[model samples]
Target: MINIPFNKPYLTGKELFYIEDAVKKGKISGNGYYTQLCQKYFESKYGFNKCLLTTSCTDALEMAAILIDIKEGDEVIMPSYTFVSTANAFVLRGAKIVFADSRLDHPGIDEDQLESLITSKTKAIVPVHYAGVACDMDKIMNLANQYGLYVIEDAAQAIDSFYTGKDGIKKALGSIGHLAAFSFHETKNIISGEGGMLAINDRKFAERAEIIWEKGTNRSAFFRGEVDKYGWVDIGSSFLPSEIIAAFLWAQLENLEDIQQVRIAHWENYHQKLQEWTSDNLIQLPVIPSYATNNGHMFYLICKNLKQRTTIIDNLKSEGILSVFHYISLHRSQFYKGKNFNTVLKQTDIFSDCLLRLPMYYELKVEDVIYKITEK
Candidate 1:
């Protein structure tokens, strides 16, 4: 039986050459030559004010939490239909997480409901670009400005995605947020085994970001000779990734356009083939808003309910294909149970029960997609 995985890291041939070069240079630690190259690529390509590669997206989110200065009892609003790290990062900073519902058409947070949740204690809004689909940033950003709230975008799946605002200006997902996090995990469009980056869009947070990423020390200042000696300056952590991983990441970044095209083809093929199921009322294909550009990070189908989702998932697994579900609505998770301050998450519950992610990766072939769909 030849089984297809839900995802597999696609490698560009340049990885070994870069890794060997890094090894020959004898600098494998964080922020070395290859690391700098990767950072510069993102900065130039994405128009990010500053880009710092982290050990993982989880680490980058934590770094954003620290940079935002989320404090105890401060309320942070975010959609519950997100990876736990999105909420856990702020929660770790002693902030109270207020769950929000997803929009009916898209799984991102409902911007209309966001304003009503704002209060004097509200500190920030984290919007997860679910499956690389852009959230309604125009509404979210306007609300953030109105309420004086910080916006941290969880763009784990939105590396190549774009949004055209109401004013006719096009912006990349990570660039629009005050601060954003990206993942290059094996399961993502790009791969570094386990890696991520923090995109600092706000100038005010740039300098402090380097120090915070380097374990709350002025080590970055010392390296640049801005200071005579480096020592602990504030609260921080070792969030930076190694140069070896950066070397691997550089290979992917070099061929990003080619990789994106391949994945986009696969995504569109799935959508085109499965669109008829919508009429049958068997499942709903992914809904991409008009303002968003496809990045080919994921392709999912919405089953009628949890029961149908479970049945489909099991059926796929039995057929030697792996399918999966997403976040379980953190507000209702075991860890958050009994927390009185949590808000109702109607859409989050619906998303959790209905959404099912299909196999999607840079190397997924058209035949494999056809096979999976035909099994239905």
Candidate 2:
């Protein structure tokens, strides 16, 4: 039996060296030498105005919620097909979730229906770039401007991806919105075991974002000798990760180009091999919009229906290959039902029951598993 796991974290072979370097530097706490290096790398490479290293994408999103001053009774609009952390971050701040529907063709939020869900109580529009594909940013941003709402991009799966707007300019996925979050989970394109970052594009949030990231204090400024002393100045939490996590992430960052190239090659191979099934109308492949570039974060198939998807999973398991379904529609979850969500989420439900993720990683050997899926 040849058992293949769904995801195996890729290492660049310098993780321990950098971690040891951090330990030798005598600063393993957050915002140390390695942390600064990781943060600066993203800012310099991607053109983000500011970057803050956090423990995880969830923590980064929570920091966004706090920086935006989400309050009780405020409404946050986002797709119902996203991860819980996207909504939970705001829910913790007492915001009412206004669940949106996924697009008919892709799993990203439907940009056309975004404005209809807005109201005076709407505080922000959180767009989760599902599978690292960019949502219709122009339309989303226009709506945000018209309604005077904040756009917090949940770019959890969008590292190294891009969005080209109507102006013929290419913007990094996490650099377009007012604030954005990125994940460095073991399953993501880059791995830091458990890490993430917050990108602040809007200048207004720059100073305050650092303050909130440092446990609501001026410790960052104090360390730079800009402030006399550090003290609690606002409502915030400890969101920064230690230098060890940052050091591991820096190692991965150094090899980002190589990692992206190999993963994208794997993505193309799957697409080419699966075209027959898709052409026969037996399954559907991922839809990449013209404005977005694939970061090869994940590759998934949409089965004809729930029953068909189940049989595919069973068949894959019989071959000793692991396949799995993606997110359950948050609107239809046990938790969301308790909140009295009644709007129909047709597309979201379809994706919930039918989307099946194949094994995809930096080192995936596509030829080894191509036979099983091809036969079915």
Each prediction's whole-model lDDT (CA): 0.90, 0.92
What would the per-residue lDDT of candidate 1 be over residues 283-345, giving only the tens digit for each residue?
888888999989999888888889988988888788778889977888889888877645578
Error of 2 at 244 (Å): 0.4
- Candidate 2 wrongly placed segments (more than 4 Å): none
Best lDDT among the predictions, by candidate number: 2
Clashes of 2: 0
> What local lDDT does model 2 show for residue 158?
96
Which lDDT tens digits does candidate 2 get at residues 39-83? 999999999999999999999999999989999999999999998
Clashing pairs in 2: none
**Ten residues in sequence with the least summed lDDT for candidate 1:** 366-375
- Superposition error at 282 for model 2 (Å): 1.8
Question: Could you estimate the TM-score for every candidate?
Answer: 0.97, 0.98
Please give the distance, in angstroms, between residue 368's alpha carbon in candidate 1 and its true position after superposition: 3.1
